[model samples]
Target: MAGREATNPGDSAILVAERLTRVLPGEVPVTLVQDASVRIGRGEFVIIRGPSGSGKSSLLYLLGLLDRPTSGRLLLEGEDTGTFDEDRLATTRLAKLGFVFQFHFLLAEFTALDNVQMPMRRLGRLDEAAQRDRAAQLLRDLGLAGHEHKRPSQLSGGQRQRVAIARALANDPVLILADEPTGALDTKSSANVHDILHDLTRERGCSVVAVTHDMAFAQGADRLIELVDGRIVS
Candidate 1:
């Protein structure tokens, strides 16, 4: 795991999913995703596009470790996830995976800065001063400097979304998984979120895999994966 490209940590793709299939139990068991395979290189911008109920969010959840796949294998930084126990999987996710959902899941009672710092706090990796500094820097970078002290309800829609983005980045994850991140925003706000994600990949070299129905946003990605009824049709 030193210098060889195959073994080197930096040379490994941040995410790889091979033949991933997920099935959920309904009155009739429904397979939500089938034989989906993807490899996301570090710093690459990848998009998953589909219509409503097309299994886009399910794919994101599997990749983000929010839900385990019913079949297939997923690797994070070349480490196989299928064998990990729940505790270990959670630890790996906290260390390497970041997630943003359609809703801005910020804590209503915490200030923006505190909300951004929550992950670090949960991980117990930073001192108070360092946590504040890191959270503040991420908030500022996401253009939420003045709103740092405000609670989620106190900020505008766009500002709240930016704060959510900042919170996702606070842990310095190698891969970011977003599910309909711009779904609730107006055109301008949606564009701003897109710009922020674009800049993140370019400037910070963070790999982003996003699920969206917006064709315009999908067009900006390095790769577009179109899912139809749980399979990649294109």
Candidate 2:
């Protein structure tokens, strides 16, 4: 892995990765990501596209702080995360980052509103009523205005995905990291998800980093980072 390069002094980067590498050990070690470096500015939508097993999702996990790098540094809002303890890292993730996965992952028993409120409740920045109100507003914003009370099982595939997106926004994070967010949806649903995410960058100034195989989704991003065999090829 190469050393970190100096970024422009005036650059307004929200997230940065310097020579990020992740390795899993076994009889023979395997590297999932290798010397990956990227920067995401506020309101920028970046799409990571690559063939399967190219480490797109692995890199996303490292950037999202869901997984630690084996040998590299990740900086969030210009702050180095190398010194953060596990608890601090968890707190940072809750306060600064949001995530949407291919699977909705909503609690099967919880209503859309309740699922969206989970993050707010965990953060404890709002009272019960306030959380509910905010959650309702997010669902409405995502075009699920009347489906708040519906469980994941009760909603259509697209609606359920929208509910998941609403849940991702529950904490009002500065950056949204999505892993194949539209992979499970039909064409129409995928387009809807793409539009919603793009609108978020324009209207809310939220940075987005999405790993996707969909060319249409990648085309809509401000920048596309292409990877090959665990390395960025473009």
lDDT of prediction 2: 0.90
What lDDT tens digits, residue by residue, belong to model 1 across residues 54-148?
89899889889888998888998888999999999888878777888888999999999999999989887889899999999999898887888
TM-score of each: 0.93, 0.96
| Candidate 2 weakest ten by summed lDDT | 1-10
Q: State, as a TM-score between 0 and 1, how close model 1 is to the true structure.
A: 0.93
Looking at candidate 1, the ten consecutive residues that score lowest on lDDT are 1-10
Instruction: Give per-residue CA lDDT, model 2, range 39-157, as digits (tens).
Output: 88888888988999999999999999999999888999989998899999999999989999999899999999999999999999999999999999999999999899988999999
